[model samples]
Target: MTQRFMRATGRLRIIFGPAHSSSLDHEMTEENQRLLKQRQAEAQQWETIRRPDGSTYVVPKNPEDKSLR
Candidate 1:
């Protein structure tokens, strides 16, 4: 068969099958999911504080120096 004839099948790929996305979340482990949630929780507690000197810094909004709220 000619190259043009064989190349025709490549055009039908979209109708033939879906592409596999390796990035799908089905691969995430339970510990990875748990860590993601924990990081989100930690991110929420931060509050931006602008000082009169225009200096900027970050500290835990509720740093008990003991527990994670």
Candidate 2:
């Protein structure tokens, strides 16, 4: 069997720079890292449940859709 890996891919942009400016690193700052971790954590909370009817459904991490507490 072959093993597969999931990767996160994205493009880089300079939010406040000129058109000729260089691109920024994806996870360049502490705040960016924090946000990435937060998003990944939230995504992991989701689940894919399979039913006896041979159907699969995705369930949200917070089924109640509550605010981030």
Task: For candidate 1, write residues 1-69 as lDDT tens digits.
Answer: 444554666666567874343534467889999999999887878777889999987777777643566
In terms of lDDT, which candidate is strongest? Answer: 1
Q: Between which residue pairs do clashes occur in model 1?
A: none
Model 2 TM-score (2 dp):
0.41
Residue 38 in candidate 2 has what lDDT?
90
Which residues of candidate 1, in runs, are more than 4 Å off?
Answer: 1-27, 52-55
Using all chains and alpha carbons, the TM-scores for the candidates as numbered come to 0.41, 0.41
Span of 10 residues, lowest total lDDT, candidate 2:
1-10
- Cα lDDT of model 2 by residue, 1-69, tens digit: 111111111122243332343445454689878998999877777888999999999887677865553
Error of 1 at 68 (Å): 2.6
